[model samples]
Target: MTSLAEATGHALDLLLAGDAGLWQIIAISFKVSGSAILLATPPALLTAFVLAYLRFPGRRLLISLFSTLLSVPAVVVGLTLYLLLSNQGPLGDWRLLFTQSAMVMGQVVLAFPILVAMGHAALQSVDKRAWETARTLGASLLRAFFMVLREARFGLLAALLAAYGRIIAEVGASMMLGGNILDYTRNIPTAIALETSKGEFAQGIALGAILLLLAFTLNGILQHVQGKGVPST
Candidate 1:
């Protein structure tokens, strides 16, 4: 108990002191995770809209593929991307391996499936009459899309939040692709891993506390959004 109390005290001190390395890790985490979420949003929204509105062959297969990918292990994503970005690989010339970009790419892939699946469901749940009413009123397809999006806004927000949560908390892809480099690719999860391994429990605990707080805050906001009102187009 004494050891645990001492460790907790030390971790709190590190956090309260705002350790420089800790701040760097936090910044890198936000940078890479935020970038991944931003990049994933448009395509995810588009794909969701398409799947919700369009009738075509192979749509089921595509949706199923995304659903399957959602369960794909992060390490697998890292391994696949690593091969693609590594020297002597097809994208080797870019020399993007072990960089922030590499981490972003891996995180993008990791988050894409969840965004697509959830966004699609959200769009699909939008009242079909909304689209019909918009078209009957002579709204352009783009306008109709915006209308539908408004109706599904809450669900869409949920999807985005979920994707952000996944990418921010992921370690496998970040470590494998970012190489967990200090002050660069190192994020909360990866830093926690490295620090724990090195017996730097204070840093690890501090980061863990930060990550938990972030997750709680995000989830609370999402719940508030969902609870406030239903989306109306």
Candidate 2:
């Protein structure tokens, strides 16, 4: 108990003192995860819309694939991405491996299925009459689509928030593709892993605390957005 208390005190000191490395890791984490979510949102939204409204061949298969992917292990994603970005792989010439972009790419892939699935649910929950009413009022197909989207805005926002939560908390893909390089690709999860392994429990605890705070802040924002009826950007 004494050792635990001492460790807690040390962790608090590190956090209060504003360690530079910790801040760098936090920044990198936000940058990679934020960028991944942003880049993924458009396609996810479009795919969800199609899945919810359009009836075509293989739609069920596509939905099934995404559902399966939602349960996919993070390590599998990391290994798959690593192989694709390795020297002998198709994308090897790009030299993207071990970079922030690589980490973002992996996260984007990881988050895509969740975004698509949830977004589809949100869109499907909208009233069909809403779309018909807009169409009857002479709204173009695009305008009617937007109207349906507006009604489902809250659910869509939920999807975005969920995707953000997943990407930010994930460690495997980021570590594998980014190489967890200090001051570069290192993020909260990767930093926590590396620090704990090295017996730097104080820094690890501090990062873990920050990560928990981030999760809380995100959930708060999600609730606010849902209450405000704001359209996800």
Candidate 3:
């Protein structure tokens, strides 16, 4: 108990003292995950828009496919990318393996499906009349697109937060693709794994605390957004 207490105190000190190594890990985490989510969002949301509004053939299959992807393990994604980016693989010429770019790619894959599936759900919540009325008013398709998006903004924000939450903390994809190189591709989850494996419980505790605080803050914002513009009972 005394040792645990000591480790906890040290963890708090590291977090409070602005530890450079720790902050660097945190920065890498945000950089990779942020890039992944941003790059993935527009495409994912566009695809979701299509799936939600279009009635083309095989649409149901596509929706089901994305929904299924939501359940795929992160390790599977990491392995697949690892194979593709490895020497002798199709994309080996790019030589992206064991790099932050590869980590971003892995995370983009991990976040894409969640954004698509959840974005589709969010778009589905909008009243079809909103689209019809906008068109009826002679609003250009682009304008109507923004209008529908406006209606679904809160839910879309929720999806964004959820996707960010997932990729930010995912260890497998980052670990396999990044090799967890310190001061390079190292990130929060991978760093925590390293610290814990080495029995350096303090840093791991600090990083874990960050993840918990992040999750709580995100949930709080989501709840607030969801409640906005709604009549209070």
Candidate 4:
């Protein structure tokens, strides 16, 4: 067995040498998670907008449902989707199981609630007068909507980054949906899980390092964005 220090050194060497296999796993993670976030974003923003600004029947119920979803475990999500996509399931004809699309679907489900919840909180923080003033100035409904969004931009951006961070690091959904296939759907988290399980600590540690760095970077960016929201004294 390789010593921990030796494995650490080798991991750094693999990273510095730009190992193709490692980068491929990273790329697949970006591709799947990126696609999921993009697909999830528009609807999340619209839903958050409605939840924050519109007074409708059962609105509170909807908000509570989304908040509840935020706490659901990732593996449970993976299991539910697994059954839905399995051959015995209704949607199985689409043959999406163990594919990147399946991974994207799982991630979209995981990300949507976070985006909606956080985006709603952000939009809710804006002064209602911002929306009214835009309309009072003779702006079209769509125009006024955008004006409100601009006022809440920093918060929305933070929500987006936070959602991205969650999906990118999650292993359960990707493992079940993507199958951790080499040179294919294997992503950072799934790859790390596999490597660690197989006693390939060097690769696991290297990938773990990447995720840590990514997390720090996202946190820094979130702080910066929130800072921009504050009035300069």
Off by over 4 Å in 3: 231-233
- TM-score to native of every candidate shown: 0.96, 0.92, 0.96, 0.97
Clashing pairs in 2: none
Candidate 2, residues 97-143, lDDT tens digits: the string is 99999999999998999999999999988877887899999999989
Q: Name the candidate, 1 or 4, with the larger lDDT value.
A: 4
Model 3 Cα lDDT, one tens digit per residue, 1-233? 23888999999999999999999999999899999999999999999999999999999999999999998999999999999999978999999999999999999999999999999999998889989989999999999998998888998999999999999999999999999999999999999999888889999999999999999999999999888945312
Which candidate achieves the best lDDT against the true structure?
3
Model 2 clash tally, residue pairs: 0
lDDT of 4: 0.92
Residue 54, candidate 4: C-alpha displacement in angstroms: 0.6
Worst 10 residues of 2 by lDDT: 224-233
Clashes (candidate 4): 0
| RMSD of model 1 against the true structure | 1.7
In model 1, pairs of residues that clash are none
The TM-score, computed over Cα atoms with residue i paired to residue i, of candidate 3 is 0.96
Candidate 4 lDDT over residue span 86-132, tens digit each: 99988899999999999999999999999999999989999899989
**Models sorted by TM-score, best on top:** 4, 3, 1, 2
